[model samples]
Structure formats: C-alpha cells, structure tokens
Target: MSHVSRSAAVPPDDLSGPLTLDDLENRADKAYARHMETYTAVTVLHRVHMDHAVWNDTASDTLGLAREMVTAYRDVTRKEWYEAYIAWATAAGFEIPADMVNDGTDIPTGAADDPPDHPVY
Candidate 1:
C-alpha cells in the first residue's frame, strides 16, 4: 500500500485566533487534494485485488461473485465513486465488463444473478 499524507485537513497556522479567508481556501484545497489522492489509491487497490489476488485463475461464476461485490459497493456510494473507478479502469484498459454494472431495481435482497452450474476453475 502507498503512504498518503496523514496531515489534518486544516490550513497552516498564523499568529491569529481563527483562520482567515485565504487560510480557509488553502484548507479547502488541501482537503480536496487529499480526497482525490485517497480516491485514486482506493481505485488502484480495487483493480489490483480484482485482477491479481481475487480473480487469479478463477472461474467465471466466481468472477460474477466479485462483480456482485463491486456493484453492491457501487450502490452504497451512490455510483459516484464507482463511476470514477470505471473511468480509471477504462483508462487502464481494464474494461469493467457489462456484467458488473447492475440494473437499479427494487428486487428482494439475496436474489441476483445465479452462479453457473459446474463452474470451472
């Protein structure tokens, strides 16, 4: 894992009780940049985990399971972060298969695409 800066999302201090507008702007920039860095890091980790460790010589049925996980996470994040990840994956030639993008529906829980029978390793 890469080491991201652990600094607080606050601006540098000066000889003042509270922050000024400039200080607030600087703090905002810092916070946004930090958020972007963490976002990129998470995208990288997800791709590596999917392509290397999780799906290494894995079966298509198991791959569906992984896609299901990605979709579930996408749902939690309201698909915003997932869209960023999709862009990153596409740029990296990962081509997130269509199966991964789940259709938004109010179906009952635990009722999704079933795994293939006699799934090959």
Candidate 2:
C-alpha cells in the first residue's frame, strides 16, 4: 500500500525529494484510496439519489453489494471519516446521496455492519 495508514495517509516524512522506490508503495496506496473514494461517490449517487427501481434493479442491486464489499480495505478510522465527511458535506449545502431514499424506518443498527475496512475494499 502507499503507507497510507502507516503514515496517516501520506508519504513518509523522510522522503522529501524526488519520487523513488521507497515511496512507490505509498503512492500506490494513495491512488487506491482516491479511486475507491471516487467509486463510492458515484455508486452513492446512482444507487441512492437516482431512481434504481426504474431499471431492472440488477444494476442497483449490484451497486448496493459493491458499496458494502469495498469497505474491507479501510481501517476503522477511515470508515468513520467517510461517514462524517458525508454528513459534513451535506450540511455544507453539497447535494449528497443518502443510504436510503423515501424510507423513514430508521433501524438503530442499520449502519452497524462490520465497516472494518474503509468501506470494505
């Protein structure tokens, strides 16, 4: 990985100059995080805000699974960070997708799955 959590999501402090093999792994980890974040964001948009029932429900079903499946690679902190970020962004007037739409049944444990990974990467 890109030494992401190892250095709290960044290259090591010692590597201040050009990119070398020593920092390659860290860079890769950073790339992984970036891609994963982008993917989750898109999936959220389509799977939540967009009407999935209009389609065959196959894509939405798969996207739902993908959303939960990718969380395995992230640490606990990263997972909480993402959730908090969503709330913050929404409060900041940024349109964000909810986990569920038109559903008012709030189960206390709805979001209590094993989010040990960033989102289950």
TM-score, every prediction:
0.30, 0.27
Per-model lDDT: 0.43, 0.43
Question: Deviation in angstroms for 54 in model 1?
Answer: 6.4
Q: Which ten residues in a row have the lowest lDDT in candidate 2?
A: 1-10
C-alpha-based local distance difference test score of model 2: 0.43
Residue-pair clashes per prediction, in order, are 0, 14
Per-residue lDDT for 77-109 in model 1, tens only? 434444444433433345465655546653212
TM-score of candidate 2 versus the correct structure, residues matched by position:
0.27
Least lDDT summed over 10 consecutive residues: which range in candidate 1? 107-116
lDDT of 2 by residue, 4-113 (tens): 23222222334675333324444445544653574455555454635535655676677666655554433343444444443333333445445522244431122433
Error of 2 at 64 (Å): 1.1
Question: For this target, which candidate reaches the highest TM-score against the unseen true structure?
Answer: 1
